[model samples]
Target: MAELWKSLPSWVRNIVVPVLVLVLAWNIVTFVFGVVGALLAMLVKLLVVVGIAAAVVILVKKAAKS
Candidate 1:
């Protein structure tokens, strides 16, 4: 597993993981917000902004590590 990781270029091993993680995290945030937003607010539109911000933060942090 470690060897396989090493075989890839740095951008793939580093940037790609963070990007995939960010996408997955963003999806999860959206799903959770959808369920709660419907119950809590008249509009669920605000959640998209928050989710994008959270996903960007996650991506930035992960990218910084690399």
Candidate 2:
């Protein structure tokens, strides 16, 4: 394999090989970013829910005291 790769011209080794690798990996990169974005969005939603629940508890406590 190394011999076959070495047999190729320098332009194919330097530029074409890297470009093909990136093109092949592009879908994988996009999938990873999409998963991360979804996770972050879910985390934000959880935080918002917790905040609202806390506020309701506080309001209930205040009403009970009064």
Candidate 3:
């Protein structure tokens, strides 16, 4: 494997390899960010639902007291 790598042209070893590494890293980062974004969206939705439920309960309690 070392012999095979050493046989490659200088451009492939330097430029192409770095570019490929960057592309792979970018893809991994994008995927992780997408997952985090999805989780955050779900959390926000859950919070909104809980907020609305709480508001309803408060209104009902207030009405009962009146």
Worst 10 residues of 2 by lDDT: 22-31
Query: 1-66, model 2: which lDDT tens digit per residue?
Result: 999999999999999999999987998899999999999999999999999999999999999999
Give the best candidate by lDDT.
3
- TM-score preference between candidates 2 and 3, better one: 3
User: What is the alpha-carbon lDDT for the whole of candidate 3?
Assistant: 0.99
The number of clashing residue pairs in each candidate reads 0, 0, 0
Between candidates 2 and 3, name the one with more favorable lDDT. 3
> Which portions of model 2 show Cα errors greater than 4 Å?
1-20
lDDT scores of the candidates, listed in order: 0.89, 0.98, 0.99
Better of 1 and 3 by lDDT: 3
Residue pairs in candidate 3 whose N, alpha carbon or C atoms collide under 3 angstroms: none
Best-matching candidate per TM-score? 3
What TM-score fits each model? 0.48, 0.68, 0.80
lDDT of 1 by residue, 1-66 (tens): 999988999999789989999999999999999988787774555687788899999999999999
For candidate 3, report its TM-score. Answer: 0.80
CA shift of 38, model 1, Å: 3.1
